[model samples]
Target: MQVKDKVVIVTGAGSGIGRATALHFAHFGAKVVVSDIDLEKAQKVADEIVTNFGESLPIKANVAQYEEVENLIQHTVTAFGRLDVMVNNAGIGPKQLLKTAEHTLEDWEAVIAVNQTGVFYGMKLALQQMLKQGSGNIVNVASLAGLKASINNLSYSASKFAVVGMTKSAALEYAKTGIRINAVCPGYTESALLDKLLSARPDMDTMLKSIIPMKRYGDAKEIADAIVWLASDQTKFMTGQTLILDGGTSL
Candidate 1:
């Protein structure tokens, strides 16, 4: 599917996979709305896109908040005149060892609020606009953890699993409305978050790489390509599906 002239919104666009996706979409002639909690970082990404001769608007928003998400959609429509795609990619995965039954409830709630509730709010608002337009696409970024269980982080895994379920259910509900909803579940990817994890547990990095059949980590751009395609016409017939990018880890 051609990305030319498409108006796409990418949440958590300040860094990592979100940043990569936003830049890639802009390079493909899409008008991008880059949203992040870090306004400065989001603006920097927007400026970089503009410097590269692409159109982009950076807005500060916490996807966990419904009001902020509503404003994000409103601002994008106000700026681009229409909304074609919404990428629900903003999420956090702070390492939380569940070895102790005394894990902080606050941490658990925070993860679920952002990773699961955030995606729900995004889909809700995006669907509202898309229903009005009669056509749209929603590409949710889940994780390999969504499909499998995580021994170390129970909350993160549960939240992601919820995302997988939500994506499928929403896709089925909106398929006849010309709105396709799908998810991309990525395995260990090379990103700033991974670097932090490696620093904390140096040996775990090698262990993770060996677990993937390819014996390597994925690049952010590789995930971005899958998301862009899922958001385009190439996947018009596809919905209610979870496209895995795990390098055969799940196989």
Candidate 2:
């Protein structure tokens, strides 16, 4: 176990990429805090972790709220004694695809609230705890869209691009302070998020695959594996880096 007994917090752990990351952390012997907007889903993942491998706690917090995000970090430290790893994995896309001109104010705001502001909250709180502890690892989830423009994904692209900027800026500021920060930009992963996207825009399924030279989507577990590896000491020399796991699509 690369991170034996390390206390790790994963936001948006109710389902999709978040759930998979939480479970992977637990499997490698980390104490995981499964945090989600839905307490029930968080509890289920935490319960599964307790049943199978390491210890876990379920926490309900809307990442869009600063107080809730603060509480999530505070609670994890109170229960586990320290914060070693933090995965800012909570994010949202717009409810419906709209062009730049047709986008509603509400839709844009909602996506920014969670995807951008939420990530900021998690990183700030985790840093407060880690700066005191003198070391930590932070992994923010970005998207291939962050690397370039995507069709029908205006708000999401903007938010994810902001995340990328945040990750790099923080990593530079703390490069020598014993904390490492990085981001993972995934492309067309297999998760509830992708399912919903495909469901809403059936044409997207075909359109999304056309750009991938590999002609395949990534798995949630695959993304989780990258997050886990980045959190480990094995990658101590790496920071301010955006590792794009997009099945060679960026190529």
Candidate 3:
């Protein structure tokens, strides 16, 4: 249950919440596997962990592709001997105005492929390994939009909702198999993604703060801490649950 010495894989660990979680887990002594589409960014994170925390592995893989995801899992197992935890966190949120329903089918397909199918692939492969080991944890990174409808981005919301549903369904199916599955729904976190959104509409920054009780964005570390706890022994009795770290925004 302790994070120490456990082999953990975090996808999209190059920046934002993914990077924070990778560093946090490594700091706690987990054998961290940092996978991202950007090889340079992944390596940077892995280097930092190795320099400060002693051990880490960097791998470049696109989560949206089944073959890439399979290879990521295979490589991690080959290197670490066993996979203890898998964090499905790689995603994209390209903003599109509903007024412009003229959006291409390609864009919609790309978003769903990465956000929804990526999680599905990660869960499927991770569960396979965990079932063999008779124990493992899977923590998915969903969004607040998954819980409620977000204006302007219909595709992102739908994809995230799928993540939430998949998390619950997988948890029920594997409840007796010693593999725990759960999700963390974060809202308005300080990340590159959010920064891009805010830059597009600076007024949204204040508007968001006014709506949330906290009056500010949540930190990446806060989300990372929640993930670690959910993935650790502290939540052994919990599964198929979605932990919302939205600073009371959803309240």
Candidate 4:
């Protein structure tokens, strides 16, 4: 689990799970690239890493755009020479939940652009660099909604399911090439995304907790730990698998 000196890139590294993952990877002595659509936030995270005696580089890139993601990879390689692990963690959901029929095409497209197509670009571009290096790891951040249907989150659910599928498919295609791809499906985690959802419907918090056997929302660091583990040599033999850290919510 050392990952010392490995070049790692974490998209959406500005806050929440993404931020935690960046810090965690840096903690393990990895040269981390903190990428996000928000340059200010990304830089702040990078500064924090530096303050903690870690190496980090903050770059701005919206994962939804192909060129930006391409530039992100390029900038990373320019700075670190090679990419060892890529965390496709940037994603967004509708501000308000809506039934499938009530979801507008605009809403669906927006979520899909960031959550699904964004992952495709990340994986494709990252694969190109990894292939040259002959060894690399990829970790996708999906959700419990991916494995199970959500009540009123058609776009989000669909996008995450696509992520899970893509992770498995890509993992198989690159299985023999020293490139391992996997996904982490987290449930009810204490992220800014969850805070927004709960803010909208305060009562939903209690309802959500009641359904989880753990009776508590997971900490961001908890999920970050799992992502780091999956990306480390300890799980070198693992690939094409979805590691669920939802406290039995999927069960």
Best by the lDDT measure: 4
Candidate 4 C-alpha lDDT tens digits along 26-55: 998999999999999999999999899488
Q: What is the lDDT of residue 145 in candidate 4?
A: 92
Candidate 1 at residue 20, lDDT?
A: 93
Error of model 3, residue 26, in angstroms: 0.8
Error of 2 at 200 (Å): 1.2
Candidate 3 C-alpha lDDT tens digits along 1-251: 37999999999999999999999999889999999999999999999999999678999999999999999999999999999999999998865545337655766788899999999999999999999999999999999999998867877888999999999999999999999999999998999888888888888888999989989899999999999889998889999999999989998
Q: State the local distance difference test value for candidate 3.
A: 0.92
lDDT of 4 at 99: 94
Ranking by TM-score: 4, 2, 3, 1
Point out where model 2 deviates above 4 Å.
none
lDDT for each residue of candidate 2 in 58-123, tens digit (9 for 90 to 100): 999999999999999999999999999999998888888888988878888999999999999999
TM-score of 3: 0.97
Candidates 1 and 2 compared by TM-score, better number: 2
Q: Give candidate 3's error at residue 72 in angstroms.
A: 0.3
Against the unseen true structure, what C-alpha lDDT does each candidate score? 0.91, 0.93, 0.92, 0.95
Q: Candidate 1's residue-wise lDDT over 1-251, tens digit each?
A: 47889999999999999999999899888999999999999999999999995899999999989999999999999998889999999988756565437556876888888999999999999999999999999999999999997777778788899999999999989989999999999999987767877888899988998899999999999999999999888778999899999888998
lDDT of 4: 0.95
TM-score of 2: 0.98
